[model samples]
Target chain A: MLNIKDLHVKLEEEDKVILKGVDLDVPAGAVHAIMGPNGSGKSTLSYVLSGRDGYEVTAGAATLDGADLLVLDPEERASAGLFLAFQYPVEIPGVGNMTFLRTALNAQKKARGEDEVSAGDFLKLIREKAKSLKIDADMLKRPVNVGFSGGEKKRNEILQMAMLEPKMCILDETDSGLDVDAMRLVSEGVNALRDAGRSFLVITHYQRLLDHIKPDVVHIMANGRIVKTGGPELALEVENNGYADILEEVA
Target chain B: MGLPADKSDATADRLAALTMPDGASWARIAREAASTRFQAMGLPGRRDEYWRFTQPDTLNAIQPPEAALYPPEDPPAFSALDRLSVVFRDGIFDPEASDDLALEGLEIERLSTATQADFHWAKDLYGVLETRGQDPVERPFAALNTAFATDGVVLRATKKILKPIHFRYLHEKTDSDAILHFVVRVEEGAELTLLEGGPAAARFNKCMEIDVADRGSFHHIRAQGRDHERRAVTHLFARLGEESTFKSFTLTANGRLTRNEAVIELTGDNATAHIAGAAVGDGDFHHDDTVFVTHDAVNCESRQVFKKVLKNGAVGAFQGKILVKEGAQKTDGYQISQSLLLDEDAQFLAKPELEIYADDVICSHGSTTGAIDEEALFYLRSRGVSASEAQDLLVLAFLAEAIEEIESEEIADDILTRLESWLVRHRG
Candidate 1:
């Protein structure tokens, strides 16, 4: 569902290369996990794929469902079935959570030439989704992420992912701020959305999250390139021994 | 001290073009007093401390600069509400378009006719609050409005009023210059809501003086008209009694120049006053809000909130002050002024002040001018919102605090709808 070919990205404001000759592919219905140390270009990969500003894709290409994603605007990419669950959800002071969700859903629908959802139907759907995520009505009514706890923010992100139902989902460090209970809840939410037509690229540092989501494959990333690709046991291998041995062997 | 030569000359030139309307002996006396005060202070100049951020040239000129009239496209504001409509066309009362001048729990009349009576309730408040507001700082334009206003409404509420009174000013002539003064008295235990909208003229000057008796309440919501070339200067002076409450909110969009000044005095213990405004401006637009609140009695509270959205080199300015007099213990005052600049060329200038003579008081003021948050923008766009739609949402969010000051949800929604349309129309 998602493909990257020799992806090279550099910071726009300075002369520094963050992602150098990185390539990865996640087929439909499969979950792939990428484990890397800090500053290893894990988050940069997600940002570049999502078409965020301040980054120049110098040399390679990324595509979702066989459509070029690099040339699309961030919103256009969203309409083309790409979603990124941010590591840190932004706190918008006055935009209500429900309103934001509805606007985003309708915008994507309009861009894709689909019928816009009515307010009543949208409300019903959101209430049902929020119930499973344990997000009460008050949280939905409040300003987006304002004064929300870390768990609540992650849950909110999952709620959005569920609502949008994109084809290729990028979870960039979604487990960074979660406790054990929060991680369980978030993983449950993600696991429930797994289907044959959807794909996920789970980016994390630890194997704890992989235990709940059960990735189909694991790739150990080092210095912006995938140094190793293995099964679920690779996550446990890194957990027990750490990245030092893997880095030495790869070198 | 004698007025400066240039100031006196400018004031005289402007006054020479206006003729005060005839009225009763008391009204004449009040106008004469105001005229004397105006001559002493003269028209504000750039050298004045309060006018430093905003140029007073067009506002002080002898002949108003001609403005091209904008075609009215949207329905008039507050049209959905059941109200007592008072319509004015180019400063003159349009009796044909206005409803009957009668309502329960209130006495209302035209200022031109009301002041002609030898004895009237409006006599006590015609220029009383404006004159009292002149001390410590001079507002010569308000004095000028009192001396030479053409026409307006006079209202006195003796009981709780269920329906609001709507003042709809329609601009039809390009060179029409208008000056209007309104006097309001809310008696003890009474309440009233006043709604105003539309572009009055090419150049407009308005003054409203309100005196709220003990336990009385007054609410004001005004939308300055969407005339791209219009110029207006307005003043609101209010005095509150014990346990009285006063709240006023304004929405301004699309004007060449506008200066809205509010002076409020909490004269009795436990009184509360709040003044707020939201303004949106595009190219060639300049909006200013100057506010002053004085706490004279113990435990009085006052709040001032103002927000502006400017783009395409538009300019916005705010000058707000809160003063707690000696013996006014436990005074609580809060003031905040903020502006969102959409482009590098747009500018926001603010001055916030607090003066406390009483030691036991909580007073705080803040002012900020910033651009849109890029991270927030990216977040919204990544979720499928277009760049323009995301910006409009953020702009509305920035102005939400001031819009929330309106007590009525229905009215606030109306203002929000108007703001949304303004954003869509002004989209780059």
Candidate 2:
């Protein structure tokens, strides 16, 4: 359901290329985990897909189900069913968490030509969804991630994803700052949303996270390109031997 | 070089023609004293330090501009709260429109209605506090207000007041010049709240002198209405007794030119005071806030918070100062002035000053002028909110810091709602 062919990206301010000749495809109803070392253009791919500023796509094409994603604005991209769970969630002070969520959910709904969710309905749904994720009423009431723990921020991202329910979800280093318990809670939150229609692209360095949310296909990414595509066993190889052996063999 | 300039003297001639408050008592003497003071000071000039950032010509106009009275878009700011309403139309008291001039635990009398015996206590107060504010700096307009103002209220609180004294200044006539003075005295252990709102006139010069006795509390909140063509200059002078509490907050919307000044002195040990302002201007608008606060007694605290939002070439200025006197040890003073310019054309100018003589005091002041935070804007937009919606949220957040200084949550919420509507209307 997601496609990137010969995708090339670079920083807009400086002449630095981050992505070069990268090609990847994730089929519907499957989970794909990409393992790579530092500077593999993994985070760049996520930012470019989500339409962040300060990045320019130089060549090639990236699309979702035949729709060109490059031309749409970030909000439009979100409405068109693309979600990026940022590695570091932004802190918006003075904007209440509940108010932010309702505003965002209704905005996306209006963009999709659907009925706006009433405040009462939003509160009930958020409460139910947050309960399973271990989010309390106080956390939901505070300003959006203003003084939240790393785990709380991750849980909030998952809450937003569940609320928006986008078809294509990309988790960029969601496991970076999470502890074992927090990781378990986050993985469970993501796993509960897994279905035959929704696809996932999980970009992480460690295979430990893969144990909790198992990926159907594993890809080794290096030098801004997918060097090899394998099954779950590839994650084991990288976890046990580290990417040193694979880098040498590819070189 | 400028051909023996006498432009400033012309305003002095205009003030000479206006009638002064009449009486054979101390009130009249106060007016005569203020008249002499104003005649010497004339009007503030561009070269003067106080009027540096703001234009002084409009305030010195020989005649009030022939402005059409703005049709108000919102009702009086404090209408939702319970209050004793006093109405002024064209700067004249409207008995028919106002409630009966009676409130428990408080004595209210019109300035014009006071007779020889009735003016006994008020005569001592009419311009007493105003003269005290002129030391270290001169406010020619406030002295002018004191010298000529013939209409206002003499209010005194003897005990805890049950309801706020609300003054609704209604503008009905165009090109009207209004000079108003209000004198308030809160006695020992008493409490009082005073609320003022609306555009009083096309050209308005107003001053209020307040005295809070030992252990008394006084609260003042004002909403300067949206009248882009109106020119107004106002001042508030206050003195606090030992252990007294004083707080004042103001909200200003659109106006052609507005200069609001407050001079406060905390004399009583352990007294606390806070003065805050939140103003929003868009298109041909100019608003100024000049505040000076003094701590004269030990262990007293004071705060000054001012925020402004300007857009579409609107201009805003803030000049605030906090002073701690010698031997006023353990004093706490905090002051901040900030402006959120919506675009490049809008501008904000600020001068924040702190004069502290006390060796053991905590005094801090800050000033900032900036556009909206792009990262925060993007964060909101990335969640699917429209650009305009995201900006509105950030603007409200910027103003919320100053609005929080208001003591009453209900009134604060009301003001917030008004700001939201203002933002929506100004969004292009």
Candidate 3:
């Protein structure tokens, strides 16, 4: 469902190459996890895939179900079923969470020539989803990410992804600030969204979340390239032994 | 170094004398009082304390006589909605288009012929809460307005009256200067919401005096004209009663030279007041909003927020002062003034002052002036929102803090729509 062949990305206004000759593919109904040490292009890959500005795709191509993803803007990529769980969601004051979510959903629907959701139905759906995510009713009334705790913001990101129901979701360090309970709750929300037609590219450094979601494959990335691919057991090995040994072997 | 001083002085004298109201028993007294104040203050100069932050030269050059007092050539038809409408043409009251507005325990009428009983309450309270003597500057126009002020509106809500009141002050262009004075009194335990619009053509000077009796409440919203050529100064002075609440909002979208002076005095214990204003100026428009709040009783609270958007030689100023008098303990006051300067030629000045003679009071003031954040711009652009659209959203958000306080839903929505359109036009 998602493909990136020999992707090479460079930082804008500089010759520094952050991602070099990386290849990755996730088939339908599959979950993929990428583990890497700091400075190993973990976030750069996500930024490049998400089509964020300031990251130039120096070479290669990225596609979602045979359609070019690199050519689309972030919102277009979002409407095309591509979701990126930001490491730090931006705080947008005065833009209520419910309003922002409804706008995004309606924009996506409008792009696809679908009927717009009524306010009543939208409120109902959001309430149900937010409840399952352990989100308070008042949280949706506040500005997006404004005054939200670190863990609450992460959970809200997943809640948005659940509401969006994207075809391919890239989770980048979503577990960094979650407590034990919040991590389990967030993992459960992500797990409930898993199905035969969805794909996930979970990026993380800890094995704790993987134990809950259980990815189908794990890839080791270093120096902007994926040098190792194995089943879910590789996550445990990397977690116990750390990424230094893997980095040496990959180099 | 500039235009000859005598030429301007002679011009002002001609204009003031030329614009005096027509013959009436009260006209002489009004003119005498007005000329006395005008003579004492002359035209506000740069050296004046209150005129320090404001451009007094432009005001000095203005000497408009009473503008044309005629009906609108083609007045916009009012919709079928059951609203109490009062229309003014060129600063003259028009009874043909106004509603009688007979609500229980409330009276809305033109000030010209109101009986002694009708104005007895206002006459007892008018100018009782004065800021001129407190500030060392002689406000030439305010004094002039007071001296010549006549025949506007007297809206009084009796005790415990809850009905809303709508006031529309429409200003049309005339060849002369126009001035209006409004008096409002909300009696004890009475509540009133006032929606006022200075939708006028250039050449109108408006002043409003309001007082809230013990336990009375008042909410006033005013939108100034949207013409850079029009020159205006609107003074709003309000006094709050015990346990009473007062809130006022002033919006300045366009004007050549406009000033809105709002004063709220919490004279009763546990009284609260909030004063907020927003202005977006373009061309050589100059807009200033000066707010003053005094807490005289214990446990009173006051808040002031002001925002301005300037572009292309436009100038904006915000000078807010909060005072806590002696024995007014436990006073809580917060003030903030911010501006977004869109062009180098555009200038903004924000001055926030606090004077607290009482101990154990919480008061703080903040001011910020800067362009939009580039990082946030990049983020919005990355999301596919065009630069102009993103800016419009941000600017609206910046101004929303003040606009949101408006109590009237219909009027607030109308103002918001107008503001949105203004933002779109100026986004470039």
Q: Which candidate is the best by lDDT?
A: 1
Worst 10 residues of 1 chain B by lDDT: B67-76
Clashing pairs in model 2, backbone N/Cα/C closer than 3 A: none
- How well does each candidate superpose onto the true structure, as a TM-score? 0.99, 0.94, 0.88
Order the candidates by DockQ, highest first — what do you get?
1, 2, 3
Tell the DockQ for candidate 3: 0.29
Candidate 3 residues A14-123, lDDT tens each? 99998999999999989999988888898888888777778889899999999999998776777788888888777777667886778677767876778988999999
What is the C-alpha local distance difference test score of each model? 0.94, 0.88, 0.76
Q: In terms of TM-score, which candidate is stronger, 2 or 3? A: 2
TM-score of chain A of 2: 0.98
Instruction: Quote the lDDT for A143 in model 2.
Output: 86
CA lDDT, candidate 1, residue B240: 99
Rank all candidate structures by their lDDT, best first, as comma-separated numbers.
1, 2, 3
Query: Which regions in candidate 1 have their CA more than 4 angstroms from the true location?
Result: none
Q: How accurate locally is residue B193 in candidate 2, as Cα lDDT from 0 to 100?
A: 90
What tier of docking accuracy does candidate 1 attain? high
lDDT of 2 by residue, B1-428 (tens): 22124744675577767998666567677888999888777778887799999997778887888668777656668888988999888788888999887888899988776523544677777788999999888898999998898688889999999898988988888888888889899999999999998888888899999999999999998888774578999999999999999999998888788999999999999999999999999999889999999999999999999999999999999999998999989999999999999999999999999999999999999999989888777777777887888899888888877888888898888788878888898997
